[model samples]
Target: MFFFFRKMNAVYLAAITAAFFMVACQTNPNAKKLDTGTEGTIHISVDETYQPLIDSEIKVFESLYPKAHIIPTYKPEVECFKDLLNDSARLIIVTRDFNQQERDYFKQIKITPNSLLLAWDALALVVNKANPDSALNMNQVRGIMDGTNKDRKWQLVFDNANSSTVRYIMDSINKGKPLPTNTMAAKTNPEVVDYVSKNKDAIGVIGVSWISDPNDSLSIAFTEKVSVVRLRADNGSDFVKPYQAYIGIGSYPLKRGFYFCLKEPYRGLGSGFATFLGSYEGQLIIKQFRLFPARLNVVFREANLK
Candidate 1:
């Protein structure tokens, strides 16, 4: 009888232990239930430089589906990447694609992030309407960027210290050289336009969308305040602004590709939004903004008058 009781007690304890672990395994304390992506909410990070265009896209996306909720956070390019890598954000929109090292790191973690080319974005240089010089070549821009130019009267202003515009100048144009000492950093793109508008000598580097679409009120206001600089080609033959034709034809020297990187493993909200962004409607929105759509064909119409 004593042996029988002892064996029964052991069996009871084992059953209890198994049940505890089973419950714990089913409900992991740290595991969050990711959204199904169709009806639930999700957060997306976008580069601050592309706010005007991305904001318009989101407004249309949410209006089509009443059940879905999307919260967009706009920050500097580097911080946007940080939010994505830390899992705070499942999607990120910015310039450029992932490098080999980034791909390898994602592979190690068993996550192959998918990306889409959304549009061709260009950095536009704006100056006060009062400024006499409205055209600049790569050399003049480079000189202003690095503070070695003969024209000390021109002051360079950027969106912010961490903006992709500054990164592009430093990494691509200046070959990783330091920025000029006379540079100013504004809190946002609108501020850049405002500063340039008020200061005759201030030359602001900004994303073209800030002043591209005439339909947008902000863009109209921006155009009223500043003059978009016509950039001279390296060969010195033609001068063009960040107009759609120039960006599409690859003549705009300060242009970059806007892309979205999504890391959702399942067909969640991320997958749905990514599909939408590359779809016809999304591309249309991009076209309306006057940027070059990456996934769609853009037709320019001209009437010949004899």
Candidate 2:
């Protein structure tokens, strides 16, 4: 009777231990360690243009790791790189890649980042929905940004100072021509949207990701207010628009990749967040924005591939 009782007690304890671990595994892989550490702070710097998407990504990350707190700092795309070089930040999220010169500088500094390509986006040319014109060829866009075209303007085409839209248009399409002297300069994209919304002659250039994701409230709102411009091969090959579908399918002519450049190996919460953003979960967040998630396979609408 004594031996039987001891055996039953041992079996009960073993079953209890197994159940505890099973429950812990079902909750979160990090849950067991949650109480072992106190609060941790991390700083993430991102370009203003990507603030919206990066903000969303960070939110999702926090939800998964409740104890982690991240403070995000926003600056211009160029300035974000400047901060990284100065060691003021551990991470930077931006729309462009490091140029050859910048890459060489990093090599000299002995800092090679573990880069993660987050998603694919495009520079878009937008006109007021009220405008009669809805399409622009690459040459036409180039002319507007580089001042090579005389027909584009607020007085003639639409007046808006070349923001990133104009800058990218010039750099990518025209190489380096100055924007038309008559271009109007709006302080931000929203201002551009507002100006174009009210003025039929005005056109705006922006990133396709800004208005592509209908599920994202902010993106949908922008799409509802402005008209996205379409592009075509001047030889009448095909008319391409800035829809996520068109861009994903490689039909859009102005696509670019978004990247994250970290200053060094992460040490704490920043590292955790970085790993999360570069992980499968984080890439899914990118796909949710209607941009093509990179370094991970994500499915989009069938039209996106065509």
Q: TM per model?
A: 0.85, 0.75
Residues 1-306 of candidate 1 have per-residue lDDT tens digits of 999999999999999999999888789887676676567899889899888788888888889877788889999988887887889888988887777887898999999899888999888999999898998899988888887788757888999899888888898788977887878898899999999999999999898887876476432233778999989878657888887777888888888888998888788887888888899998888876767888987676887979
Residue pairs of candidate 1 with colliding backbone atoms? 37-268, 37-269
Candidate 2 stretches greater than 4 Å from native: 1-39, 151-167, 213-222, 234-236, 298-306
Q: What's the lDDT for residue 234 in model 2?
A: 51
lDDT tens digits, residue span 1-306, model 2: 999999999999999999998887889756533311224666777766665677888788777777777789876666678888888887788777777888899899887766667778777677777775677776776666666667645422322232344456667776765555666666565666677778877766665655556476543333678787778855546777755565666788888778887765535565567677778888777766666666685466545554
Compared with the true structure, model 2 gives a TM-score of 0.75
- The C-alpha RMSD of each candidate to the native structure, in angstroms, is 5.3, 9.9
What clash pairs does model 2 have?
A: 126-204, 153-157, 153-158, 154-158, 154-159, 159-184, 160-184, 161-184, 161-185
| Candidate 1 RMSD to the correct structure | 5.3
Q: Which has the greatest lDDT?
A: 1
- Candidate lDDT scores, in order, read 0.84, 0.68
